[model samples]
Target: MNALFPALRTRTDLPALRFGAETLTYEDLGRAAGALVTPILGAGRVAVWATPTAATAVGVVAALLAGVPAIPINPRTGERELAHILGDSMPGAVLAGADDVLPAGLADVPRIDVETAVDHHSPVSAASAFSGAEPDDPESPALIVYTSGTTGPPKGVVLSHRAIAASLDALEEAWAWTEDDVLVHALPLFHVHGLILGILGPLRRGGSVRHLGAFSVEGVARELGAGGGTMLFGVPTMYHRIADALGDDPALVRALGGARLLVSGSAALPVHDHERITAATGRTVIERYGMTETLMNTGVPVGSRPRPGSVGLPLRDVELRLVEEDGTELRAYDGESVGEIQVKGPNLFTAYLNRPDATAAAFDGDWFRTGDMAVREPDGYVRIVGRKATDLIKSGGYKIGAGEIENALLEHPAVLEAAVTGAPDPDLGERIVAWVVPADAEKPPTAGELADHVAGLLAPHKRPRTVHFLRALPRNDMGKLLKKALPEALHG
Candidate 1:
């Protein structure tokens, strides 16, 4: 029930963060925050757009410490979507870099140029005024995160301090993180994966983190080989590229070997990539399940047997139930049935800001009915089938989760990324279709060959009936497959 920044400021001399060529101890960061807060007093909400660095992290912490809600908008979003979020959040001021593009309407707001803010000399002031007051009641909104809208326009999810605290505490307990641990931080700050798990989670536990402004396979491998960090969190795509870059470096191998844990999320990992990573790193990549709404629900246990292809059990204080198509709750002990996943826990977001209708529709009493389909194994492990109705491909009376076919397709040597959708067919009600990104354009696999490859690994009904090769697969801002957009793109 304590505000995070205020609590951390007490241990001012501890190593706080390392980014690029810069470093900031907790004391320096607290003072920097105090300086930033001085001019922005009474600003209820502040929007920030800065280069992903220690400065940006300090800015967010500074805003929180000042009792101002911080909204970190993605720099690459279209002006239209950017304007919508700004209008909705109604920020009192904006902190943006000179090079950052802003919506046309944003010029009217008070601006704090980030380029000049970070250049100020060491802040010479007491940090007490900036320390936020006692925990905003557990349900009071602390952060607003926008999820990529598959159903409609994006909506802001209001997360409370208690919700975030629950997630971090559960993560630390499940993974056994200690103050001595150092985390590698290269993921985007706009996403919960990086903002919460990558930064806040480690910081809350007194652990150190090294932040990377961007992800480059060669650059990241070099950092890992240097061996200062002990844990890595990345999306599946990032892991694939990093594994490929390591090739045969003994130092890279040793660094990966030394890490306490390597985590993957955002998208499901192809079993082929998973195998390659384990072979090269000697560490099984721990895949966890989460979304913008629920920070994190489950993860494969550290130092225990990692059940391959499963996301592992629910974290401490997380409760999960699987419901059948008939609206009946499926027994968790049943080994053969797959059902929709509904979760209720302290870590789940309270509601979508300004979207009371969505808040009402997303839940059933206390449980938030996550639109993900999963099956619980006899051993208490849960393997994701994929998203609920939207991602379920119906072809010739058989229902197949697109993720499964895509996962199988990725195992082929030539396939780089794959998206599966149902295409209109004359004979079948809906036909299985796949759009793929090939690693080698000069030697792309034929539709027949790719279909055969998938058929060899899957049942005839589950194999993709048609295939098309593309330069890249489409993904939303958060790196989730845009299945609804696929049918249009495929036919367009």
Candidate 2:
């Protein structure tokens, strides 16, 4: 019965969640979630208004308690994407906070307003006896998380209870996690990094989480300095802000230095941020790699030495392998040979919901093609180069990774953020073009200077042939640079 949330009932007296001014004890959450059983049970699928609110957490937890497949819709999704998700997932009901105003597209779906209260009490059920009804099969779909539609329309990834359980358990083991650990993050509730890992990871271990509602450097310092949080999780943007503010704030330096582990994911944290954080706080920021299809494939274990930009070893029970472009498996772990990563494990989603062809294409035999390009160290640690389609740039006589050159540009004091892409050129098959956000717009570094910086770190051929300056790089809610949407957003 406790397969999905192993510690839901057992962690009764412990403080379970805090978002802004609202707080919920484990006991309080149990009753609130229990009350939702009647409404959610028997419903095959539901939708959640994924806002950074306490009610959003309650609604998701309630759906999990009732064994219903919950599809979390990003609150900021565009009209077209929102329409696509609504039509594709076709959830029976949509759960929203009491204050959320329904969009015109969601007018047809039955709406359930989740109460934001957390102090209501009820008799604590036995750990084995909680809930409305348990799914007879653990393989029943628990969540239908939609993918980021970079190539085409977004597809719903069906995650079963068994997959969710395997993922959280493996993370617990990898991080040496326990109930004593207090997690802190201000990420959104729509994606895996925020919803599954940020929310469910702590609950599975009977631990506590303090959600900041929204990320801010001040919020981070306030919580870590006096909030008693032992571990912190964030995307690269959040870390970038922290790194930028560290030189001016002593409290931030102390708070970050005192934490047990600092994790960065969703997108790679620039190597410069890693160095800045380490230099200021003596804390090595850890990075992990995963996607919507696979909750978590690899991470830096709590006690391990963090290789600055590497995502570290594959998690417990996850098997990761690198394959060449032609699909042959690469057996050598030389730390420099790059290949596409394919994973096989219990932590993968069952299939892309309702798309048989898409589901079939995602897997080869038993391994799921991750579409990410990376190299493996001799010690089995993995280092991601970039994605196969967009981030792999073949220029001149060399195949280069855009992520490496972007990191090099970020290392320059004049650059704030950088994204590298390939543009067709007559000389070099596809030349490297960099989109840069300068630290100081009025005194921005010249294109030649930034190109020289990349050439200095990497090679002469790997440097960007042209540079375009922007006020800010277009990014999704999860801090992933929307490379596909860049031209439309930047040029037009």
TM-score of 2: 0.96
Q: What overall lDDT goes with each candidate model? A: 0.76, 0.86
Over 226-269, each residue of candidate 2 has an lDDT whose tens digit, in order, gives 99888899999999999989999999999999998789999899
Name the best candidate (by TM-score).
2
Clashing pairs in 1: 12-27
Model 1 global lDDT (CA atoms, 0 to 1): 0.76
Total residue pair clashes for candidate 1: 1
lDDT of 1 by residue, 1-492 (tens): 136643365566777788877777766666666667766656777877645777667767666666566777776767777777888888888876555666676788888754323323554432564544434566666678777655667798888878888999888888998787888858888778988888787778877888877876655555555847888888877887767866766666787777888888877877777888788877888889988899999988887675656788999999998998776999966544678899999999988878899999999899898899888888788888788766666678775777778888988888988888777778887888889989898999888888888888987787778888777667765566777766566566
